[model samples]
Target: MHAAVGLALISLLILLLLPFAHHAVLFGAEGLGIGTLRDTYLIAVDAPFGNLAISGHMLAGAVVTLLAPLQLIPWLRMRHPGWHRWSGRVITLLGLVTGAAGLVHILSRGTIGGWVMDLGFGLYGLLLMLACVQTLRTARAGRMRDHRAWALRTFWLAIGSWLYRVHYGLWYLATDGLASNPDFSGTFDLMQNFAFYLPYLLIVELWLRLQRRGV
Candidate 1:
Protein backbone atom coordinates (compact mmCIF):
# COMPACT_ATOMS: atom_id res chain seq x y z
CA MET A 1 0.00 0.00 0.00
CA HIS A 2 2.87 2.34 0.72
CA ALA A 3 4.31 1.65 -2.70
CA ALA A 4 0.95 2.06 -4.34
CA VAL A 5 0.52 5.37 -2.62
CA GLY A 6 4.00 6.29 -3.70
CA LEU A 7 3.01 5.43 -7.21
CA ALA A 8 -0.06 7.62 -6.92
CA LEU A 9 1.76 10.55 -5.37
CA ILE A 10 4.55 10.31 -7.87
CA SER A 11 2.03 10.02 -10.66
CA LEU A 12 0.31 13.11 -9.42
CA LEU A 13 3.59 14.96 -9.47
CA ILE A 14 4.18 13.79 -13.01
CA LEU A 15 0.68 14.83 -13.90
CA LEU A 16 1.45 18.26 -12.53
CA LEU A 17 4.50 18.29 -14.75
CA LEU A 18 2.85 16.58 -17.70
CA PRO A 19 1.16 19.65 -19.06
CA PHE A 20 4.62 20.94 -19.84
CA ALA A 21 5.64 17.70 -21.61
CA HIS A 22 9.37 16.94 -22.05
CA HIS A 23 10.37 20.29 -20.67
CA ALA A 24 9.83 19.16 -17.08
CA VAL A 25 13.02 17.15 -16.83
CA LEU A 26 15.43 19.42 -18.65
CA PHE A 27 18.90 19.16 -17.15
CA GLY A 28 22.47 18.61 -18.33
CA ALA A 29 23.63 18.14 -21.92
CA GLU A 30 23.45 14.42 -21.21
CA GLY A 31 19.73 14.68 -20.65
CA LEU A 32 20.57 14.94 -16.97
CA GLY A 33 17.12 13.75 -15.93
CA ILE A 34 14.66 11.12 -17.22
CA GLY A 35 11.47 10.86 -19.31
CA THR A 36 10.74 11.50 -22.99
CA LEU A 37 8.25 14.19 -22.16
CA ARG A 38 8.81 16.26 -25.29
CA ASP A 39 5.78 17.66 -27.04
CA THR A 40 7.75 17.86 -30.26
CA TYR A 41 8.41 14.13 -30.29
CA LEU A 42 4.87 13.38 -29.26
CA ILE A 43 3.45 15.80 -31.82
CA ALA A 44 4.79 14.07 -34.87
CA VAL A 45 5.32 10.70 -33.18
CA ASP A 46 4.75 8.75 -36.41
CA ALA A 47 4.47 11.53 -38.93
CA PRO A 48 3.16 9.66 -41.95
CA PHE A 49 0.61 7.97 -39.77
CA GLY A 50 -1.11 11.27 -39.05
CA ASN A 51 -1.51 12.20 -35.37
CA LEU A 52 -2.83 8.86 -34.26
CA ALA A 53 0.31 7.93 -32.36
CA ILE A 54 0.66 11.24 -30.56
CA SER A 55 -3.00 11.36 -29.76
CA GLY A 56 -2.84 7.86 -28.37
CA HIS A 57 0.14 8.73 -26.20
CA MET A 58 -1.61 11.72 -24.65
CA LEU A 59 -4.84 9.76 -24.23
CA ALA A 60 -3.03 6.86 -22.60
CA GLY A 61 -1.41 9.13 -20.05
CA ALA A 62 -4.79 10.61 -19.30
CA VAL A 63 -6.35 7.22 -18.66
CA VAL A 64 -3.54 6.10 -16.39
CA THR A 65 -3.35 9.40 -14.59
CA LEU A 66 -7.04 10.09 -14.25
CA LEU A 67 -8.74 6.71 -14.05
CA ALA A 68 -6.40 3.76 -13.39
CA PRO A 69 -5.63 4.85 -9.82
CA LEU A 70 -9.19 4.71 -8.68
CA GLN A 71 -9.38 1.05 -9.61
CA LEU A 72 -6.75 0.39 -7.00
CA ILE A 73 -9.20 0.94 -4.20
CA PRO A 74 -10.37 -2.38 -2.76
CA TRP A 75 -13.97 -1.36 -2.46
CA LEU A 76 -13.92 0.17 -5.91
CA ARG A 77 -12.52 -3.06 -7.33
CA MET A 78 -15.29 -5.08 -5.74
CA ARG A 79 -18.00 -2.66 -6.72
CA HIS A 80 -16.87 -2.32 -10.32
CA PRO A 81 -15.57 -5.51 -11.83
CA GLY A 82 -17.15 -4.62 -15.13
CA TRP A 83 -15.58 -1.19 -15.13
CA HIS A 84 -12.32 -2.72 -14.02
CA ARG A 85 -12.20 -5.10 -16.96
CA TRP A 86 -13.10 -2.38 -19.41
CA SER A 87 -10.53 0.00 -17.98
CA GLY A 88 -7.94 -2.77 -17.93
CA ARG A 89 -8.48 -3.27 -21.61
CA VAL A 90 -7.96 0.45 -22.17
CA ILE A 91 -4.75 0.39 -20.16
CA THR A 92 -3.43 -2.64 -22.04
CA LEU A 93 -4.13 -1.11 -25.43
CA LEU A 94 -2.89 2.35 -24.50
CA GLY A 95 0.27 0.99 -22.95
CA LEU A 96 1.17 -0.81 -26.19
CA VAL A 97 0.33 1.94 -28.66
CA THR A 98 1.81 4.79 -26.67
CA GLY A 99 4.79 2.74 -25.60
CA ALA A 100 5.53 1.99 -29.24
CA ALA A 101 5.23 5.64 -30.16
CA GLY A 102 7.44 6.55 -27.23
CA LEU A 103 10.05 4.12 -28.54
CA VAL A 104 10.09 5.87 -31.87
CA HIS A 105 10.51 9.22 -30.16
CA ILE A 106 13.28 7.88 -27.95
CA LEU A 107 15.21 6.36 -30.86
CA SER A 108 15.08 9.51 -32.93
CA ARG A 109 16.90 11.44 -30.22
CA GLY A 110 20.16 9.71 -31.25
CA THR A 111 21.98 10.31 -27.97
CA ILE A 112 23.51 7.60 -25.76
CA GLY A 113 20.83 8.21 -23.18
CA GLY A 114 18.43 8.42 -26.09
CA TRP A 115 19.29 4.87 -27.01
CA VAL A 116 19.00 3.73 -23.41
CA MET A 117 15.86 5.73 -23.00
CA ASP A 118 14.35 4.18 -26.09
CA LEU A 119 15.23 0.70 -24.94
CA GLY A 120 13.84 1.36 -21.48
CA PHE A 121 10.49 2.52 -22.80
CA GLY A 122 10.47 -0.06 -25.59
CA LEU A 123 11.10 -2.88 -23.16
CA TYR A 124 8.40 -1.39 -21.00
CA GLY A 125 6.01 -1.61 -23.94
CA LEU A 126 6.79 -5.26 -24.58
CA LEU A 127 6.56 -6.08 -20.88
CA LEU A 128 3.24 -4.30 -20.63
CA MET A 129 1.85 -6.30 -23.54
CA LEU A 130 3.17 -9.52 -22.03
CA ALA A 131 1.63 -8.61 -18.71
CA CYS A 132 -1.72 -8.07 -20.40
CA VAL A 133 -1.57 -11.47 -22.03
CA GLN A 134 -0.53 -13.06 -18.77
CA THR A 135 -3.42 -11.32 -17.08
CA LEU A 136 -5.86 -12.76 -19.59
CA ARG A 137 -4.29 -16.18 -19.29
CA THR A 138 -4.65 -16.13 -15.54
CA ALA A 139 -8.23 -15.09 -15.87
CA ARG A 140 -8.97 -17.81 -18.40
CA ALA A 141 -7.28 -20.41 -16.22
CA GLY A 142 -9.74 -19.45 -13.47
CA ARG A 143 -6.88 -18.50 -11.19
CA MET A 144 -8.45 -15.50 -9.54
CA ARG A 145 -5.58 -15.01 -7.15
CA ASP A 146 -3.03 -15.22 -9.91
CA HIS A 147 -5.17 -12.90 -11.95
CA ARG A 148 -5.09 -10.48 -9.08
CA ALA A 149 -1.33 -10.82 -8.83
CA TRP A 150 -0.72 -10.33 -12.52
CA ALA A 151 -3.12 -7.44 -12.45
CA LEU A 152 -0.83 -5.73 -9.99
CA ARG A 153 2.18 -6.50 -12.16
CA THR A 154 0.51 -5.08 -15.23
CA PHE A 155 -0.70 -2.08 -13.29
CA TRP A 156 2.79 -1.30 -12.03
CA LEU A 157 4.23 -1.44 -15.52
CA ALA A 158 1.49 0.84 -16.72
CA ILE A 159 2.09 3.12 -13.79
CA GLY A 160 5.79 3.01 -14.66
CA SER A 161 5.28 6.12 -16.72
CA TRP A 162 4.64 7.79 -13.42
CA LEU A 163 7.33 5.90 -11.47
CA TYR A 164 10.06 6.94 -13.90
CA ARG A 165 9.44 10.62 -13.22
CA VAL A 166 9.35 10.24 -9.44
CA HIS A 167 12.45 8.07 -9.42
CA TYR A 168 14.30 10.67 -11.45
CA GLY A 169 13.14 13.44 -9.12
CA LEU A 170 14.33 11.69 -5.96
CA TRP A 171 17.53 10.71 -7.70
CA TYR A 172 17.96 14.35 -8.58
CA LEU A 173 17.32 15.66 -5.08
CA ALA A 174 19.62 13.01 -3.57
CA THR A 175 22.56 13.17 -5.96
CA ASP A 176 22.93 16.93 -6.39
CA GLY A 177 21.77 16.04 -9.89
CA LEU A 178 23.14 17.39 -13.10
CA ALA A 179 21.90 20.79 -14.11
CA SER A 180 23.29 20.77 -17.64
CA ASN A 181 23.34 17.22 -18.90
CA PRO A 182 20.44 14.83 -19.34
CA ASP A 183 22.84 12.09 -20.31
CA PHE A 184 24.79 12.55 -17.08
CA SER A 185 21.81 12.11 -14.84
CA GLY A 186 20.03 9.53 -16.94
CA THR A 187 23.36 7.79 -17.64
CA PHE A 188 23.88 4.31 -19.01
CA ASP A 189 25.91 1.61 -17.30
CA LEU A 190 24.76 -2.01 -17.26
CA MET A 191 25.47 -2.50 -13.55
CA GLN A 192 23.58 0.64 -12.57
CA ASN A 193 20.57 -0.61 -14.49
CA PHE A 194 20.52 -3.65 -12.24
CA ALA A 195 18.74 -1.30 -9.89
CA PHE A 196 15.99 -0.93 -12.47
CA TYR A 197 14.26 -4.30 -13.06
CA LEU A 198 15.55 -5.92 -9.87
CA PRO A 199 13.75 -3.50 -7.61
CA TYR A 200 10.72 -3.61 -9.89
CA LEU A 201 10.50 -7.40 -9.95
CA LEU A 202 11.31 -7.55 -6.25
CA ILE A 203 8.36 -5.33 -5.57
CA VAL A 204 6.17 -7.71 -7.52
CA GLU A 205 7.58 -10.71 -5.70
CA LEU A 206 7.07 -9.11 -2.30
CA TRP A 207 3.56 -8.08 -3.19
CA LEU A 208 2.62 -11.57 -4.34
CA ARG A 209 4.24 -13.18 -1.34
CA LEU A 210 2.33 -10.97 1.01
CA GLN A 211 -0.91 -11.70 -0.79
CA ARG A 212 -0.13 -15.40 -0.39
CA ARG A 213 0.55 -14.95 3.30
CA GLY A 214 -2.64 -12.86 3.56
CA VAL A 215 -0.60 -10.05 5.06
Candidate 2:
Protein backbone atom coordinates (compact mmCIF):
# COMPACT_ATOMS: atom_id res chain seq x y z
CA MET A 1 0.00 0.00 0.00
CA HIS A 2 2.78 2.39 0.91
CA ALA A 3 4.67 1.55 -2.25
CA ALA A 4 1.55 2.07 -4.33
CA VAL A 5 0.93 5.42 -2.72
CA GLY A 6 4.52 6.49 -3.20
CA LEU A 7 4.37 5.54 -6.86
CA ALA A 8 1.15 7.49 -7.32
CA LEU A 9 2.67 10.57 -5.73
CA ILE A 10 5.84 10.34 -7.76
CA SER A 11 3.83 9.96 -10.92
CA LEU A 12 1.62 12.92 -10.08
CA LEU A 13 4.65 15.02 -9.22
CA ILE A 14 6.36 14.23 -12.49
CA LEU A 15 3.20 15.00 -14.41
CA LEU A 16 2.83 18.38 -12.77
CA LEU A 17 6.53 19.17 -13.07
CA LEU A 18 6.96 18.46 -16.79
CA PRO A 19 5.62 21.75 -18.15
CA PHE A 20 7.08 23.74 -15.30
CA ALA A 21 10.52 22.32 -15.91
CA HIS A 22 10.22 22.98 -19.61
CA HIS A 23 9.22 26.55 -18.96
CA ALA A 24 12.12 27.03 -16.53
CA VAL A 25 14.58 25.70 -19.09
CA LEU A 26 13.29 28.04 -21.76
CA PHE A 27 13.23 31.00 -19.39
CA GLY A 28 16.76 30.28 -18.23
CA ALA A 29 17.98 30.00 -21.79
CA GLU A 30 16.37 33.28 -22.73
CA GLY A 31 17.70 35.02 -19.65
CA LEU A 32 21.21 33.88 -20.53
CA GLY A 33 20.78 35.17 -24.10
CA ILE A 34 20.53 31.79 -25.79
CA GLY A 35 17.14 33.07 -26.93
CA THR A 36 15.48 36.44 -27.12
CA LEU A 37 14.54 38.10 -23.86
CA ARG A 38 10.93 38.82 -24.64
CA ASP A 39 10.02 39.12 -20.96
CA THR A 40 11.84 42.12 -19.65
CA TYR A 41 10.08 41.75 -16.33
CA LEU A 42 12.46 38.97 -15.41
CA ILE A 43 15.31 39.43 -17.85
CA ALA A 44 16.31 43.01 -18.52
CA VAL A 45 19.15 44.30 -20.69
CA ASP A 46 20.27 46.74 -18.03
CA ALA A 47 20.41 44.35 -15.07
CA PRO A 48 23.07 41.83 -15.95
CA PHE A 49 23.71 40.58 -12.42
CA GLY A 50 20.04 40.16 -11.63
CA ASN A 51 19.48 38.43 -14.94
CA LEU A 52 22.34 36.03 -14.38
CA ALA A 53 21.28 35.25 -10.84
CA ILE A 54 17.64 34.57 -11.71
CA SER A 55 18.61 32.61 -14.81
CA GLY A 56 20.95 30.38 -12.87
CA HIS A 57 18.29 29.97 -10.21
CA MET A 58 15.72 28.85 -12.76
CA LEU A 59 18.06 26.35 -14.41
CA ALA A 60 19.20 24.84 -11.15
CA GLY A 61 15.65 24.81 -9.80
CA ALA A 62 14.45 22.92 -12.85
CA VAL A 63 16.96 20.14 -12.29
CA VAL A 64 16.26 20.02 -8.58
CA THR A 65 12.51 19.75 -9.10
CA LEU A 66 12.82 16.94 -11.62
CA LEU A 67 15.51 14.98 -9.76
CA ALA A 68 13.96 15.25 -6.29
CA PRO A 69 11.17 12.71 -6.78
CA LEU A 70 13.62 10.03 -7.90
CA GLN A 71 15.63 10.54 -4.75
CA LEU A 72 12.64 9.44 -2.68
CA ILE A 73 12.43 5.96 -4.17
CA PRO A 74 13.26 3.50 -1.40
CA TRP A 75 14.17 0.58 -3.65
CA LEU A 76 16.49 2.68 -5.76
CA ARG A 77 18.21 3.95 -2.65
CA MET A 78 18.52 0.44 -1.24
CA ARG A 79 19.87 -1.11 -4.43
CA HIS A 80 21.93 1.80 -5.68
CA PRO A 81 23.39 3.57 -2.69
CA GLY A 82 26.14 5.18 -4.74
CA TRP A 83 23.62 6.70 -7.12
CA HIS A 84 21.62 7.95 -4.18
CA ARG A 85 24.63 9.59 -2.56
CA TRP A 86 25.82 11.24 -5.76
CA SER A 87 22.39 12.44 -6.67
CA GLY A 88 21.82 13.73 -3.18
CA ARG A 89 25.04 15.68 -3.46
CA VAL A 90 23.95 17.17 -6.75
CA ILE A 91 20.52 18.05 -5.32
CA THR A 92 22.09 19.69 -2.30
CA LEU A 93 24.48 21.74 -4.37
CA LEU A 94 21.83 22.79 -6.83
CA GLY A 95 19.43 23.56 -4.00
CA LEU A 96 22.00 25.87 -2.46
CA VAL A 97 22.67 27.53 -5.80
CA THR A 98 18.97 27.93 -6.40
CA GLY A 99 18.36 29.53 -3.04
CA ALA A 100 21.39 31.80 -3.15
CA ALA A 101 20.74 32.94 -6.68
CA GLY A 102 17.15 33.76 -5.77
CA LEU A 103 18.30 35.83 -2.83
CA VAL A 104 20.78 37.61 -5.03
CA HIS A 105 18.10 38.43 -7.56
CA ILE A 106 15.73 39.71 -4.88
CA LEU A 107 18.49 41.88 -3.44
CA SER A 108 19.57 43.17 -6.81
CA ARG A 109 16.33 43.64 -8.72
CA GLY A 110 13.55 43.25 -6.13
CA THR A 111 10.23 41.58 -6.86
CA ILE A 112 7.33 43.31 -8.62
CA GLY A 113 5.09 43.17 -5.55
CA GLY A 114 7.45 45.31 -3.51
CA TRP A 115 8.50 44.85 0.15
CA VAL A 116 5.89 42.29 1.18
CA MET A 117 6.83 39.99 -1.66
CA ASP A 118 10.48 40.62 -1.06
CA LEU A 119 10.17 39.75 2.62
CA GLY A 120 8.26 36.54 1.94
CA PHE A 121 10.54 35.40 -0.88
CA GLY A 122 13.64 36.32 1.08
CA LEU A 123 12.44 34.16 3.98
CA TYR A 124 11.69 31.30 1.60
CA GLY A 125 15.20 31.46 0.14
CA LEU A 126 16.75 31.46 3.60
CA LEU A 127 14.70 28.43 4.68
CA LEU A 128 15.62 26.56 1.52
CA MET A 129 19.31 27.18 2.11
CA LEU A 130 18.95 26.15 5.72
CA ALA A 131 17.22 22.91 4.79
CA CYS A 132 19.90 22.09 2.21
CA VAL A 133 22.71 22.76 4.67
CA GLN A 134 21.08 20.71 7.41
CA THR A 135 20.42 17.82 5.03
CA LEU A 136 24.09 17.69 4.09
CA ARG A 137 25.35 18.17 7.60
CA THR A 138 23.12 15.49 9.12
CA ALA A 139 24.01 13.03 6.40
CA ARG A 140 27.69 13.64 6.87
CA ALA A 141 27.32 13.00 10.58
CA GLY A 142 25.64 9.63 9.84
CA ARG A 143 22.37 10.71 11.38
CA MET A 144 19.96 9.00 9.09
CA ARG A 145 16.88 9.96 11.06
CA ASP A 146 17.59 13.67 11.06
CA HIS A 147 18.94 13.38 7.54
CA ARG A 148 15.66 11.97 6.27
CA ALA A 149 13.63 14.71 7.92
CA TRP A 150 15.82 17.41 6.50
CA ALA A 151 15.84 15.72 3.10
CA LEU A 152 12.04 15.82 3.04
CA ARG A 153 12.14 19.52 3.86
CA THR A 154 14.68 20.09 1.14
CA PHE A 155 12.55 18.19 -1.36
CA TRP A 156 9.48 20.33 -0.66
CA LEU A 157 11.52 23.52 -0.95
CA ALA A 158 13.24 22.37 -4.14
CA ILE A 159 9.91 22.16 -5.93
CA GLY A 160 8.50 25.37 -4.46
CA SER A 161 8.80 27.44 -7.65
CA TRP A 162 6.69 24.98 -9.57
CA LEU A 163 4.22 24.86 -6.72
CA TYR A 164 3.94 28.62 -6.81
CA ARG A 165 2.82 28.50 -10.41
CA VAL A 166 0.51 25.57 -9.73
CA HIS A 167 -1.20 27.53 -6.98
CA TYR A 168 -1.78 30.53 -9.24
CA GLY A 169 -3.04 28.34 -12.05
CA LEU A 170 -5.53 26.63 -9.80
CA TRP A 171 -6.59 29.89 -8.20
CA TYR A 172 -7.21 31.61 -11.50
CA LEU A 173 -9.20 28.63 -12.72
CA ALA A 174 -11.40 28.70 -9.66
CA THR A 175 -11.81 32.43 -9.13
CA ASP A 176 -11.49 33.85 -12.64
CA GLY A 177 -8.65 36.10 -11.46
CA LEU A 178 -10.44 37.30 -8.37
CA ALA A 179 -8.31 39.41 -6.07
CA SER A 180 -5.30 38.96 -8.31
CA ASN A 181 -3.55 41.78 -10.12
CA PRO A 182 -0.69 41.99 -12.57
CA ASP A 183 1.55 43.56 -9.95
CA PHE A 184 0.71 40.79 -7.42
CA SER A 185 -0.13 43.06 -4.52
CA GLY A 186 -3.69 41.92 -4.01
CA THR A 187 -4.89 40.11 -0.89
CA PHE A 188 -4.67 36.65 -2.39
CA ASP A 189 -1.37 37.42 -4.09
CA LEU A 190 0.09 38.74 -0.86
CA MET A 191 -0.96 35.57 0.95
CA GLN A 192 0.49 33.46 -1.86
CA ASN A 193 3.95 34.94 -1.50
CA PHE A 194 4.52 32.59 1.44
CA ALA A 195 1.66 30.16 1.10
CA PHE A 196 3.18 27.87 -1.53
CA TYR A 197 5.98 26.62 0.71
CA LEU A 198 5.16 27.44 4.31
CA PRO A 199 2.00 25.37 4.61
CA TYR A 200 3.74 22.42 3.00
CA LEU A 201 6.64 22.81 5.37
CA LEU A 202 4.21 22.93 8.26
CA ILE A 203 2.70 19.68 7.07
CA VAL A 204 6.15 18.15 6.84
CA GLU A 205 6.82 19.19 10.39
CA LEU A 206 3.61 17.57 11.55
CA TRP A 207 4.49 14.39 9.69
CA LEU A 208 7.93 14.36 11.23
CA ARG A 209 6.49 14.78 14.67
CA LEU A 210 4.04 11.97 14.06
CA GLN A 211 6.84 9.70 12.91
CA ARG A 212 8.87 10.49 16.00
CA ARG A 213 5.89 9.61 18.14
CA GLY A 214 5.30 6.45 16.09
CA VAL A 215 1.79 7.57 15.41
Q: Highest TM-score, which number?
A: 2
Candidate 2, residues 1-215, lDDT tens digits: the string is 59878878888889889999999899998998897777468888877777899999999989989888888888888899998898988888998899899999899889999999999999999998899889888999999999999999988988888889989999999998899999998999999999999999999999999989999
Task: Give one digit per residue, the lDDT tens place, for model 1 in 5-67.
Answer: 765775675566454343322311112213443444334433534344434454555555445
TM-score of each: 0.66, 0.96
Name the regions of candidate 1 deviating beyond 4 angstroms.
1-51, 104-112, 178-180, 184-198, 210-215
lDDT of each: 0.57, 0.90
The alpha-carbon lDDT assigned to residue 30 of candidate 2 equals 91
Looking at candidate 2, the ten consecutive residues that score lowest on lDDT are: 35-44
In model 2, the runs with Cα more than 4 Å from the true position are: none
